[model samples]
Structures are given as C-alpha cells and as structure tokens.
Target: MESIYLPTSYRSSKNLETAGYFEKYSKMCPLTWGGSSSDNFCRILEEMALNDFSEVDLSALGASCSINKLQLPSEPDNFPIEVPARLSTKSKLDFYYPVTTEATQLNVIKCKEALEKKWIRSEFKFGSKRSLKLTITDNMSNHFRNDILPGTNFIYSILIYRPFSMSMGQKHSGEKLRFAMEIEALGTNLLSQIIDAIECVSNYGVLKEVENTKVNLKQFQNAKQEYPSQTVFIDGVFYNDTRSPDAEDYSEPVIKWAREKNIGKFTVSAMETTLLNTLTPRIGYPYVYIHQGNCEHILTFSDARLIQPNDCLVSEKYPRIVSVCRSTNVLCLICGIAPSQWLVKKCDRFPQEKVFLCTDCCNSYLYIDGKKVGDFELYPFFDEKVT
Candidate 1:
C-alpha cells in the first residue's frame, strides 16, 4: 500500500542526520551551512514541536555535544600541493521530507534552475549527494519539560477531540503545539524575552488570545477580555562561527556565508512554515488519539503534596499555587482543560494532592512556590543578536 507522509518530527530529522546526513566531513573541518534569518528560524524543537534551541553559530554556541577533533587533513593526502580540503568538505542546500517509511533529499542540481535563488555547494560531492553523515541525538525530554506548553491544536482539537475534549480550545488543554508556533514567531525576538516567553510558556507559560470562536470558557465568557496564545513557528539559521567581539574584526567570507545561507535555506524554510501554518490545515501531524475524555488528563502533569503549607516562600511569578510536585517541584495541573479552576479551590487535599488551585487571575496571585518554577521554555532563539 502507498503510505502517507507526516512531517518528520524534529526527532526524525535528528536521527537522519545522526545516521549520517553530514558525517563525511567529521575527519577535517566540520563546516556546515545555516540559512538566513529574515524568513527562516534555525532552532531545534521537541515532540511537541516547541523550540528549545535555534540558529547558533557552531563555534560561538560552544560545542556542547561530545566532540572528537578532526586530524588536520593537509597532514598527508597528496600534501605537497597545500590543499585545504583537509579541513573542509562541501555540501549543498536541499529540501528534506518524510514520505511513507522513506525520506528523500532534493538538491538544486541545475545552475540555471537555481539562478534566481540558490543553495550553494559547501564543498563538493560526487553523484547528486545531498545529505551528510551527522548524527542527531534525541535529547528532547532532557530539554523540554511537561510545563513548557506550546500553542493549541486548533485543527486537531476540532477533529480529534471535539467529540470528547468538549471544545477545541480548552483553557489549559492541548495548547503546547500552537503555543510553540506563536512563541517561535516573535518569541524568537530579543533572546531573553524569547527565553522568558519560552519559560513563561515553557515550564509555566499561559496561552491567551485564541479567537473567541475557538473555545469560550463559561467563566471567561462573562469576563471582560483576555489574551489567547497565537501559534506561529518560522524557519531560521545555524552559523559556523561566533561574531568577532570587536565588530571591526568581522570578515567578508563570514558575512557572505551568513547572507548566503539565510537567503537560500533559512529564509525559504521560515516562509514555508509561516505560509503552511497560516493557510494549511493539519500543520504537521494528524492528532493522535490518546484517550476518550481529555488528553490533558493523561498528557498533563500535576503533583500537589510537594509543597508543605508551612513552606511559605513568596514567588512573584504565577502567584496562584503554593506548591506543586515534590521531586521536580513543578506546577500541578488538576486537569489540562479549565486549569484556571485550580486556582480557586484548596488543592492541598492529600487524597487529591495531585490537584490544586491557581488564583493568579483572582487577585494578587502568582505561580511561585510550585513545581512549575524554572521549566524549559523555547531555548536559544533564532539568529537575532543577543544582548
């Protein structure tokens, strides 16, 4: 049977690269390319499709993964000629996709075909090679926490959960996906806020601004106005080096390389993500049904007994809960949907200790002293300069 294709999760992308997308160059200079920032976002995301890290100049990003220095190639391979190939390998700009069990790579083969817009060949390749032998480790759970909620799943909610979840846009249910996109779009701005937005949304961010037509909380329906989360994710870049501390020290090759990558891959990818999410349905995956009543009941995390009534430390942030989980100290979600309700009730009822109330919106309330503190938000923003 002809199989259907879902967008490959970042996990798959990482796996493909890990299996050997850009591995050949590991021997010498592992110079790879990153696209532009204007239209693309080069950050990495998790299963929820929420970004944790984006466009980092490999050198400046401070190589964190395990490293094995490459032996300078000029040491011998026909050395008398003073060749640089010993330090670098060539690669090309291509598209990636997962269809059925197969993944395909498309490179710009004809020059004229790429005349107006182009993806350069980083070094050189033989028979239409488009991938490298780079390995992508799956450290998603290590980086993303249950608290970091992305955006909502409008299409999925309506299609997959409408029958059971009550409404597509429940207050606290099924939001991570949409939230991630929204945050990625502007959250990629000013690295710190991007991080905070990520944190606010991550470990414990809120989603407001979803249109009224989506979901109308009975309580909020009568309230004045509230902000819902918007969902947007753009394409980005990955640079090869850190910018010179002294601005004047910048080199033309580096500058040009930056521009080229952005224009060719980064920009293209960003535009596509934007266009698709805005105009298309089912942005990437068909919502996978986990249960009957609510995904939040199963997908969300909550632990209440973690906080002792005597543990009175003030937290200015989400002043809604007094405590959350014990070991992780994360926020406790009673149910993914209608979560604001947790704030109004006494959640310390041991038998139901896993539940609690967040009166943050009630009056001088915040989300401190709970397990939600310091969760992973979308990380390392796009190519924007960090102050």
Candidate 2:
C-alpha cells in the first residue's frame, strides 16, 4: 500500500478537518441546534495539520500495523465490519476535540438532548459485495480531564482487515492490484498499536475457527452439489467433529467467530468442534481437536447444572459426579484478556448471559454457547492424535 499523503499546511479547514478526522466524530455526535457532530480520537488525529503532525503510523508513534500483503490459506467468506462510533455529547471527555467545538460542546447534557433530536449516523461499506461494513459514530460530549475518571464515555474503534479491493503485492500476469486508497495510514495510540500488533499476531485463534467453519460449509455445499443425499465428509480433520454424526444437516451452525484471534496460530475452539475431541457412537471414527493435547481424558459432564465455580471443582462431600472438567496436562482458555473475579461477578449479576471459563492453565474461556457448550472451552476427550 502507498503511504497516505496530506497537505503540510492547514490552509483549508476541509484539508485540516479530514487530515485529523474531525468529520467522523462530528458525525458520531448527535447534533442539536443543527450544529455538526463529533468524531473520535482517530479522526481527531487525522485532522491534525500536516505541519502540527510528527508521525501518523501505528502506535501513532512507531511502526504501523500496515502490511503490504497478508495471505491466509484459510479465511472467512465474510468478516464483519466494525461500526464507527461517534463521541457522545458525553464522549468529549475521552479525547480532545476542536477548540471551537469544545467550548460549545462543553455543555454535554444540553448537547445530548439536541443530538437526540437531529443527528443521524451513516454506514459505509468497504467490500465489493458489501460483505464488510462500517458506520460513522454519532457524536457525544463529555466532561473529563486529567483524572482516571470513568464517565459516560463510550470506548470506540474501527474494524480493520485486508480491504477487498486492496492491492495484493503479488502481481498476476505482470500486473499489480490496488487496495483501498483511503485507509488511514496514521496509527492510533501506543497501547492501541500494541493491541493491534498483538491482534495481528494472535488472531489464529479466531481465524482457524472461522476457516474451519468455512471449510465445513464448502464441503457441505460441495456434497450437495455432487450428491444431495450423501453425508458431507467435513475434510475429516481432527477439529471437524461438530457433535453431529453428519454436518450436512444444519444450514448454518452459526458459531460466534472468535473475536480475539489477532495472532496467526491455532484457534482456541470448543472441544466438540476441534480435532479428535468427540465420539460418533455409530460411525467408524470418533472426532478429535488435538494434534497432541489429550483434553478428552478429564472432560466430565453432569445433568446437574454446571453453573457455579464450585461446579468446576467439586468438594469431596458433595462430589457424586459433579460437572468437573479437568486435565492432568495444562489446559488454556487463552482467547482474550483473562477475566477477573469481578468480571465473573458481573456475569453472575446477569444470569441469562454467558460467563467466561478462562483460568490459570486455560488461556481463554467461553461459556454457554449453542448445544450447552461455549466457544473455546476445551474438552479432554480425544483418544488418539489427529493426523
């Protein structure tokens, strides 16, 4: 991708506004009294006069997440686009705003009422089939400065990926393909860039799962195309069990694609969906998820509700087959950030919702997905290594 170029001088408000991204936030902020909306920190930086700007790469200070071309042998048919978020009349606190807007937007509450009455957010599509999408954030105002005070600020970010039209560096027939011309080359905060880098490297978790799912879909479709009545052999891979004796049954298994597969390794998927992790009572071969980790050995289940932490580890007195799923070898729920007791408590507060099972040995956790299991929960039930 070519470097993004902005004018050095802030001669035109339009140039300066777009350079720092004033429009994005302004759109996000709902307008009252018929004024402009607000954008987020990314946009704010985008609008910086090229002269005032030092560097706009990733980490906003260092090398960016910019890659010339990234190739994934297996990838999703469609990756969901991130909706752009606006600074609320309340968000004025989370970031710096236009000096002029700041003075008027200072009255956060009053502005909110006005935005609620007027402003509307617009959605932008990036992919050819409109497979990927983004929506401009509605604006908000806030009152915060200096202190680590949590106010009505909504943390926002953009969903980034290999844009469909983006030029792949590998040329075909001596011709090069071009990518999106408007992708902001300027990076965000240092921590954000770090997070981005982490995501870029670690996303194998989600990518593997998504690719596996897509492969399964392709196999199923292929089966239907070749022989409608035939059972779809889902590549016969270790992680392809999916609990069903046959996969051609459901139209869409509808699994939640991993949200944190920023790295490019293995996906931390549910035991049932992974290689060598399941049983096909009538079939010749059982399903599996592990190339090595024998998660199937200690996976236990119970009709009893496995809701509480106590359920994870039973006490001797009441332990007459509780839902304890353990492992002699290490198990990890390494998906996203490790959830805390406080976060668990929050889950408890909302019983209808799912709780994360990520723990010390487990790198990540997923709770209560379809079929009574969750995403990324490992089950040690595999008998042999998957080829």
Task: Name the best candidate (by lDDT).
Answer: 1
lDDT of 2 by residue, 208-233 (tens): 12211112322222221232111112
What C-alpha lDDT does candidate 2 achieve relative to the native structure? 0.24
lDDT of each: 0.24, 0.24
Candidate 1: residue 80 Cα off by (Å): 92
lDDT for predicted candidate 1 compared with the true structure: 0.24
Clashes of 2: 80
Candidate 1 Cα misplacement greater than 4 A, ranges: 1-225, 234-347, 356-387
**TM-scores, all models, native as reference:** 0.16, 0.16
Candidate 1 lowest-lDDT run of ten? 152-161
Alpha-carbon runs more than 4 Å astray in model 2: 1-107, 121-169, 172-241, 248-387
